[model samples]
Target chain A: MKLSDIFKKKNSGDVAKDRLKMVLVSDRSSCSPEIMDRIKNDIIEVLSKYAEIDQDGLDIKITEMETDDKGTKSVPALYANIPIRNMHHTAK
Target chain B: MGEVIVITSGKGGVGKTTTTANVGTGLSMLNKKVVLVDTDIGLRNLDVVLGLENRIVYNLVDIVEGNCKLKQAMIKNKDNDNLYLIAAAQQRDKTSVTPEQMKKLTQELKAEFDYVIIDCPAGIEQGFKNAIAGADRAIIVTTPEVSAVRDADRIIGLLEADEMKQTQLVVNRLRPDMVKRGDMMSADDVVDVLRVDLLGIVPDDEDVVVATNRGEPLVGDSKSLAGQAYMNVCRRITGEQVPFLDLEAKKGLFGTIASVFKKK
Candidate 1:
């Protein structure tokens, strides 16, 4: 079978493959996506407890991107970004 | 210098104990003073595999409890005078021994022997934790099945978490014919998933079963194919880059000719 035929995104099986990749990444990193979501939620809760923070401006995301190697594909490393508001918020 | 190695797999029945017994015997055959420790506690079988089960008067728990000295618990291998075994307490579970005790025992063994191989129990619980606490390196055994590979990967992750530096893979019970027919995963396929250095591959040999049933490890049996593979792994462990054994069936001339034409 051709590689393209096996890996096409619209093949429906590709969804399962992607899910497996996500799961394997989480396993390799020793951090679960479920736990990461809980952590983000708790951070948001703590921010709300202190003051009114703009929820729309809050951005929490975790991503994995592979770096192109010299004629070889490399393993993807995890990246997480969580934006927090500064103490000096403009007074309403 | 003595090195402490642990053989472990997160899944059961992946030949962890068999690997430990054979490798220990192989190392001992090389004139290296080797000791095999069964950390499985209640599920202990290393002694049986080494044909020293009947000689174990004092178990590992006895040594840990101070009822007996470490020397008293060790059963010397009659076949290889340099090899010894510390049999686990079949009556007691893993909690009976702590990681501290294992560390102290391995430390003392290090002073006396050249290699200390521990057969870790299945799972990621206290037995696994205690087995790896004193290990300098690890050898993970897995079959060609997906479940075995997945569990081996989890065990590797745990070993990494403990900061166990060196880890190698031993693909056991591999059938090369099945791999060629796509009925089973190839050694290379499993290696890609685990991403670990390949140590050795043991074929699905019936001699292994006969040896195990006779309470003798395959290491000393010249006719056993698995025995030769275990010896090769022992040489590799001793810093020798021995060529991997050709356990797979040789392709026919037709297949070879086809491959040559495809390359053209």
Candidate 2:
């Protein structure tokens, strides 16, 4: 009801759509938060051996991505954002 | 033989039984001999929904256990001669019937009826397994809620894993006004998230509850929007191309004003 809130409020339908998209990713992958955490840690450990990685900035998730030109087809895709500060010169 | 279609939703209270009754009745109305089998077992409801509760002399378990013949178990609908219902045994649990027995029963029903519509119980348990055992296709019903859609996604995955690939989605209890106000998910939103072919969408109509209480499906009412939606779904099931209902256009005076504003 406030003047400032009128322009900034997001529609509930859009909010629901976003939430469903996020929840269904994990639901479809059958991956729990615990399992995702473990996967994230394992990936971090493997990458850290050869490169200096930012553990705090690392982002990973399973999301649905378009598979076709028309965007008619989609499939679950695992995306990872690993920020590396520097690479080790010597092979481990 | 006839096609055995299972009407299911992994989550409860999403109108699976109501859809089964209406679709089966609508198919029968279309002159197709239809028999609705209630596979929910302990929570038998199709009989009550169809107003054939008092006529049950024999049930599904009785026929499976050799206590009675199939003909004796099927209760004729009061409304249509072509429509019949095989009531589930109320006292017995879902464990009473195995998937093999369910398949055999549907096979037998398929020979006699044009469509054998099985109303599946909620959840991904033994009850769910028995219902889909003999289905040639599936109609997964879900509301425009987060929990229902999530459960529907799970049901779709399970059906695909079981190799029942000919599955469709029915988004029930949709509210057009709410969707217009950006307060509820539209049928398209549900289909987009579920990634399934949309069969039809039933708007959230109060007449559905009235029809359920009277043990008569709204599909035959002709006046109820939800009934028309169900009829359209049945038509699509039979491979007929029917346009989806224009729910927004039916919104009376307020809708007219909204349309005028949009044009300007």
Candidate 3:
């Protein structure tokens, strides 16, 4: 059998095998989930100073979608979306 | 003319002494002039492992304190003519000898032997510093567990801080059955996480326990698989291309077949 085929058979259903994938991804991206959360919070605070953004509508989450490498497991992607509905509000 | 290599693990019972004993024995078997130094201070056991505990007249502290010469403290291994051991002082504390003292002692040993392997005491304390002080390289031994790996990481960081150029790893006590069942981490997994050059991987063989109980190093046992792994590590230290043992193939017919071409 081919090497890739053998690797596929060996890696299937083994969640622990994702350790190297997760660790390398985090290391290469230079951002862990905790760091991403902290950055998200900082962004929210900074944007809050200029405009009023709805915390409830602000969808800040990380989604790991595989870009390429069809057979191999991919890293979780970080996603962020902020909505400023009451931007014209004045501080009283 | 020889290199001083320190075998260390931050936590106790991770097989630092056993590795030292086996590697020393293996190197000696290869006819290399090897000297194993027990730097555990108050907790000496390398001499016992080498079955030379009774022959140690002068310990490390005595030699360092000028009670005896360095040559007087070195007890020759009866089994292997080229192997020598410097036993630790079970009564003296680690503070008895400073890192500078260890450096001086090992410097002298380096001029006499082909390899000087120091069995470092557990923890990243004074004993650890003294053990690795004059070494040209280091081998960090760790098990495939979170706590051991964490401690190994800390030790590696400390070794880097000390500016040691040659630092490799030896992951011991790996259970192949568990690793195959996805219950335990494999040697590759440990290596990937540590991101260090792997010297060798030793399986969790019961022969190791038998060897320890018999007060003999497994590395010299012709039939023991763990013994062979230690030998492979010794060869790798001297720049050999020995492959890592595939623990998963250590059972039944496949094991026998794999063993035929397996790295020594």
**DockQ (Cα-based) for each candidate:** 0.09, 0.72, 0.12
Model 3 misplacement above 4 A = A1-44, A47-92, B252-264
Give the whole-model CA lDDT for all candidates, comma-separated. 0.83, 0.92, 0.84
Which pairs clash inside model 3? A63-A77, A64-A76, A64-A77
Question: Is model 2 an incorrect, acceptable, medium or high docking prediction?
Answer: medium
The weakest ten consecutive residues by lDDT in model 2 chain A span A1-10
RMSD of candidate 1 to the truth, in angstroms, is 8.4
Query: Candidate 1 overall Cα lDDT vs. reference?
Result: 0.83
The reply for model 2, stretches above 4 Å from the true place, is: A1-8, A38-59, A64-76, A82-92, B252-264
Which model scores highest in lDDT? 2
Question: Over the stretch B92-130, how does candidate 2's per-residue lDDT look in tens digits?
Answer: 999999999999999999998999999999999999999
- In model 2, residue pairs whose N, Cα or C atoms come closer than 3 Å (at least 3 residues apart or on different chains), thus clashing, are none
Lowest-lDDT window of 10 residues in candidate 2 chain B?
B249-258
What lDDT tens digits, residue by residue, belong to model 1 across residues A1-92? 68777555343323433444455666766777787778777877776665565667665544445566552334545353435465434432
Candidate 1 residue-wise lDDT, B1-264, digit = tens = 699999999999989999999999899988999999999989988887878878989988999899988888889997789899999999899899999999998999998999999999999999999999899999999997766777898998788879898999999998766666556777887787677999999888899998999888898566766888888989999999999877663334446776899999
Q: How would the candidate models be sorted by DockQ, starting from the highest?
A: 2, 3, 1
iRMSD of prediction 2? 0.5
CA error at residue B45 for candidate 2, angstroms: 1.0
